[model samples]
Target: MPKLKIEDLARIREQARRATLLREGAGRVKITVHLGTCGIAAGGRNIMTAVLREIEERNLHDVLVTTSGCAGLCSREPMMTVEVLGQPPVKYVDLTEGKVKEIFAEHIVGGKIADRYALAVGSERVM
Candidate 1:
């Protein structure tokens, strides 16, 4: 066990606060990363890391990021879904760190759907 320090405690508390806010924040948009076995093997962990990094770097306070088991598209392994409160969720596929950042900037922050990387819009498939 690590000896507790004041800085460590503060960091832990901040992380907890952020996690709580992300889970309970009202009207927050949600971003879900699929982490099934196939997805993980196909770089889901990297996708998740990229997402977290973007959130931290951009200081996104009203967005909830989470992970799901699978979307039943193993071939599309590393995928993510972004859902604004009243909008149909958009599913992005074949993700890389670069694409994730573009999605974050264009879709999440700028409110424009990035049509190129998106695999599905709501119930209709795009690619």
Candidate 2:
């Protein structure tokens, strides 16, 4: 294979920098995929893959993707929470790859919540 030129290295560096920024909370949106034991048993891995695929396909530099433990709802395993800056986070449950794609397009890209797949919008108030 031919050696990479300085320009190629620069482009790679920029891409890495943008990814770091997203992970550092500089992103406009954050998606947390629940991957607890229960979640995995319910196909959380697939959900995670779908999320990543969507981000890659769309080349979304402003979207951060992460994984988390259960959301205290085992039955709702394989779930995810989407948080858009300046708006409340929305929890979506019982997902499939197809559903994830739709959510990414409608909610993440279009700024509209996917109500059909959403479990709730925002967290419960603390006592």
Candidate 3:
């Protein structure tokens, strides 16, 4: 078995806590990345990493990141959504690392929506 270091334990705890937050989804903002077969092929992981890094670097502890299956929009496989307590959950299509950073700075931190990539959730059509 591999040895578990203190840092590993802390990361484990943090991930567990994040999972719980996604399941609850009541008081916090949850960011879910659709990672189905198509999603991964479309740079989903890159977008995910960028978003996570941005959140961590900016110290946005209220946000939780989760993963979901493909949204059935392969053309927009790298799909994501940002849900806040009092706002409608909005999805973003065709995510890229650069767009993730822009979303973080312009929307997440600036309280503005990124219309360029904003897609409607729970719909077959892309916005």
Instruction: Please name the candidate that would achieve the greatest TM-score relative to the true structure.
Output: 2
> Which pairs clash inside model 2?
none
lDDT of 1 by residue, 91-119 (tens): 99999999999999999999999999998
Candidate 1 wrong stretches, greater than 4 Å: 1-19, 23-27, 124-127
What is candidate 3's TM-score against the reference?
0.73
What's the best-to-worst order under TM-score?
A: 2, 1, 3
TM-scores of all predicted structures: 0.79, 0.84, 0.73
What is the overall TM-score of model 1 with all chains considered together? 0.79
The lDDT of model 2 is 0.92
For model 3, state the Cα shift of residue 115 in Å: 0.4
Deviation in Å, model 3, residue 108 alpha carbon:
1.4
Give the per-residue lDDT of model 2 (tens digit) for 1-127: 7799999999999988866776566889999999999999999999999999899899889998889988999998789999999999999999999999999999999999999999999987879
Question: Count of backbone clashes for each model?
Answer: 0, 0, 1
What is candidate 3's CA lDDT for residue 52? 82
